[model samples]
Target: AKQIDDLTLAIIICLSRLFLHISADSKYYQSFFWIAMSLLQIHDTKLFASCVHFLDQIVHSMSDNGCFRGQGLATFCASARKGPSERMLAKLDQLSGLSFKYDFSFAVAGHLLKGLKNVGTKAAVTRLLNTFVEYSQENNPANVTGYFAAILPHCGDNLSESCRQRLLSCSETGSSVFNAGMVPDKIRASLLFTYLVTILKSSESEHEQLYIYKALEEGAHFMPDCLPVTFDVLMKKMEQILVASQNDQMLTAVLAIMNCVYTYGLESSSPVATLNKQYMESIGFASLGSADQFNQNQKGALIQAVCRVLDGFLQL
Candidate 1:
């Protein structure tokens, strides 16, 4: 059985690589993209590794030939050994239309994200990301926050400084690629929250902190729809503050998050309502409520915020 399984995997990998090699021409990019879409769905780790290898190869090849040319993408593809042939651009521009399919856009997003780990692929990664961003702007899909969350891995420290700056500019307020709303799916929501928590825990910049809080506010508005994952992440950070050091900024952020939860969760009728009530009781008894740790005025402010959120919940 194991031998048969291994043989099947070998054939799949070989066929995939061969297909990519044959379809490597710019005119065949739509076929190339479908092959990539299929590869990303493979479940076997070993087979998937080979899939990434060929996908990476084709991306670099297309990049070297300048198939990724455009206004915002020129800088990334400038290293093209030979500028793209006009014929190739015309053909591939047709292929770029595939980004209209949500699956196609996200498959490209997944590949570009994984490819970012290899420094050699930086230029290719940028070209692909730029293409994805351009397509997203023109289409402006509903649930766009989910798409932004899909590509959020680029926001991490691993990205090159230049690439990161470009991404920030693309996603900044009013950019067509940037969207504000509740993230659409649990997986995307989790990714969004993880990034938010990471920024909250590490970023000392007030502007950055406020940006994350705004996202938290949106997620909170959906209540138990985002449920335990979202609230769990926030509560853990709140607990960290309660048990460890005192950070007024973090405390204010947490309180603001709590207010969002109560304000939005009032009619939710999800278990989060019960869980939140329990949490409020716990916070009243936690060290966060202690006078020794927080001076009278500080404690009063904390209590006041909690009371206000609680009062609104009661009114509902």
Candidate 2:
């Protein structure tokens, strides 16, 4: 009976989170969100984990049942890499090692990816990446790239180089020769790209920023070949930011990234040049007449940064 109450309360919190954050049609979700939180303030790790798992299932059900089909999500399945087995659950029943099994679904993976650097023990990170790599080999490779995007920032730095290499090799082949699945999965890849760059914008660590920049710089080289739609989405992100961004620091960091990639293309002639030019032309940076709103100083700073990278990124 006590366990039943916890599950009942958790389901309510789950609904509150999904609807409240996904859309803002009413204030009830907001009120319920806090109310659920206050109710959840307890020391029971096991109960918390169970509630989270149940919450994941609800979101997954919504996705799988065509609730968010208009939003372009094919399914809301948790992108969990490895789910706990009966044995594992039984162990949890016996002793309190971890409060609950962590969800590895793609949505959860994005959050986990950001926190991997802080996760204890190198072996743990290695095991997760290895599991992801193994899953990629068996399933659609592009799906795994979502997980890859999360991990790439910390890859290639002697931290997870072996697993990183495994990921690159697997992506080279993908799940098919024609990549029929990739075509429909573009939205997922695009959202993953957005998650990555947006996180970079909010991050305060210079070291992490460099890793993200370098990872994106390299991804610019390969996206066109493996995931063309995702490449377009990333370019759109840049163009959108360029035209609308008022934050000088953000604009500055964005330009540095552009500079790194544009510089990369100058020497290597990577396809980033072609895709970037198309995306820039689409934005019509040369005729952004909306700059009248920003003061002269902000406009000047933005224009200089845009022009510096545009000289090479744009077509003459």
Q: Estimate each model's TM-score.
A: 0.42, 0.36
Shift in Å, residue 69, candidate 2: 29
For candidate 2, give the lDDT of residue 209.
57
lDDT of 2: 0.38
Off by over 4 Å in 1: 1-29, 60-158, 173-214, 218-252, 265-316
RMSD of each: 18.7, 18.9
Per-residue lDDT over 1-316 for candidate 1, one digit per residue giving the tens place of the 0 to 100 score: 1112577557656755665556434334424433443433232334445555655555555555555545212223222212223233222222222121232333244334434434455455555454344333322232234334333434434444543444455454432232333334544444445434543554455554555655566556543344344353456656665576465765676677677666666334343434533532332211111111112333333333323333332332
Give model 1's TM-score versus the native structure: 0.42
Model 2 error, position 261 (Å):
10
Candidate 2, residue 257: lDDT: 54
